[model samples]
Target: MKDILMEIIESKRITLREQKKAVPAQLLENGASEERKMFSMRRALANSSTGIIAEFKRKSPSKGWINRDASPEEVTAAYQANGASALSILTDTPYFGGDLKDLRIARPEVNIPILRKDFIIDEYQLYQAKIIGADAVLLIAAALEKDECLQLAEKAHELGLEVLLEIHSEKELEYVDSAIDMVGVNNRNLGTFVTDVENSFRLASMLPKDMLLVSESGISSPETVKNLRQAGFRGFLIGENFMKTSNPGEALGSFIKQLN
Candidate 1:
């Protein structure tokens, strides 16, 4: 592999600089200070019968465009109506074919917790998430230094946004702590973009017992979800499976029916 994860991060740094200069942190801060509607993804997953965190993503680094013309608002509303516990909206444009506007567009359509899924390397993104109506943000352990991850999580908290720390292997388990709202096991390797759902099962017993656990990527079967639930996972972040279909919401509804 070509270390694609670092490639994305490097591109992200450039994009961040341009974004900060164009929008200014103060503007984002002021907008974020204004109270916005909020929902608790952690609570939603904990109380739900089917813990499906449906994602609104247009593309991926490995698979390229999944659903190029999907509308954020329409798909998200359908996910909620179908039985999604929460929503994960990709806000990174270069690799994910998504932008902050997706969250802004999807926010008013659903009431569930909206997690801004991206390669977060700065607090400025946290302010942007809040201002645009995100309830939570994903912090990939592979994408940050130990201290950098903790600092970003802390800043997310200060802005009243929950942090879902994503880890790929057991070493990243050390990233888990009191500040994290949820711990997610990403089945996909960021470096190679390969997926293995077993990663979640492999790490299930090691994750913090009290913390909510989420299984991200490579999950398409209801049986796998059932097995993961038994393994201690409460939230399932599934994107490509649903997004690849023409009727994503309907696909999600069918998946939930199978799950039950």
Candidate 2:
């Protein structure tokens, strides 16, 4: 079977090289350093009745072009007004059909915490996230080594961005650390592109009980969110479920209604 994760990372490196030339690291850092207050995704989930981190995505490697014409500003604002605890913006262009402009545009549209969801493997991306006004970043355990993850997480902290460490299996659990503001269990296997919401249930017990647990991907119904909440999950990172619909915010609003 082809490894989709490896392919994305390779493409990401090539994209980064071009981006780095366009915007030097020091210039990116300077922009990120400008005074900006960050909303806490962890706290938002903790305090919300529906811990829905609504995502705005155009496409995916598993299911291409989910919503090619969705406007980041319109969808994200609707998400905030309709009852989302936070927002997640996909920033990977090659596979996800998104770029930094998605987050940059969506950032000012919503007051809720916005998580920059991408195949992040470099520290330079952290600055990119911060400069674009993202409050959090997704760090996939399968995409990075322990040392690399730690270094990137530390850099994220220095830039005042929270880190959501994503793990797919028991082995990847080792990447959990103090730097992580939230621990997310990815339901889809990056290597195979297969998804099962039960993956969250299977790993829920083994994850740190005190950590803010988040269930990511393959979550279509509110019933699953309720079950995961009972299993100690505080947040649910849902994208395709809502993005695939004609109106993502309305889809998210209807999903939240079921949760209540």
Candidate 3:
């Protein structure tokens, strides 16, 4: 599994670099002419009571298929309308079956900050994220080295994009730095595809109190959000729970209504 994950990471990096180089300089120049866009998930959460960062993921390596037919606009708008503070758009292709176009499409339709939820192993992907209208990008600590995490975080900051550094366990806390805007404790174990909300609780005490904390994966109920919030989490990233339903937004609306 380690070898497979590494292969997928490497392949993603190569594909992103090539895409970056292929963009014409003229379009790049025009896009660069405008001031860089800044998306502050921290601010979004600060103003919302629920602090739900609703996600728009089509598939996953572990889950195989979540919702391949759902439109990003319909789902994201529902999340926003239902009091979601922000949106997480999975941009990883292949296993995730997501694309940068999803981010581009969702950002313009929704006002919330859009997270480019992808396996980012190289710095070029940060620029790619910005060009495609992403408000922030995910940096999984389990997949990146300590210096790599810090370096990528700095690059994302310079690009005016927020960095959400994800940790699967307490061991990944060593990668945290000032450059990271938020720290998400992923409850899902990528190696075995097992999920437990307690994984987030177990690592909450290990994170520095100065950092904004988020819990990702395995949150399906309002009770789950209440419990995680009590454990010091400021945000919750939920995807499959809503995506698996026939109407993700309506389901999210119902979920938030229950939360309130």
Best to worst by lDDT, what's the order? 1, 2, 3
Over 29-137, each residue of candidate 1 has an lDDT whose tens digit, in order, gives 8888888778999999999989999999999888899999999999999999999999999999989999999999999988899999999999999999999899999
Mind giving the per-residue lDDT tens digits that candidate 3 earns over 1-260? 36456767788878867776797545654573367456688888766788999999888887788998889888898888877889999988898889889888887788788899988887667777888888888998878889888999998887788999999877788888889889999998766668898999999988898788999999998998998888889899999999999988888889888988
Clashes of each: 0, 0, 0
Q: What is the C-alpha lDDT of each candidate?
A: 0.94, 0.92, 0.84
What overall lDDT, based on C-alpha atoms, would model 1 receive against the true structure?
0.94
Candidate ranking under TM-score, highest first, comes to 1, 2, 3
Measure candidate 1: CA RMSD. 0.7
State in Å the error of residue 26, model 2: 1.3
lDDT minimum window of 10 residues, candidate 1: 29-38
Question: By lDDT, who's the top model here?
Answer: 1
Model 3 poorest 10 in a row by lDDT: 24-33
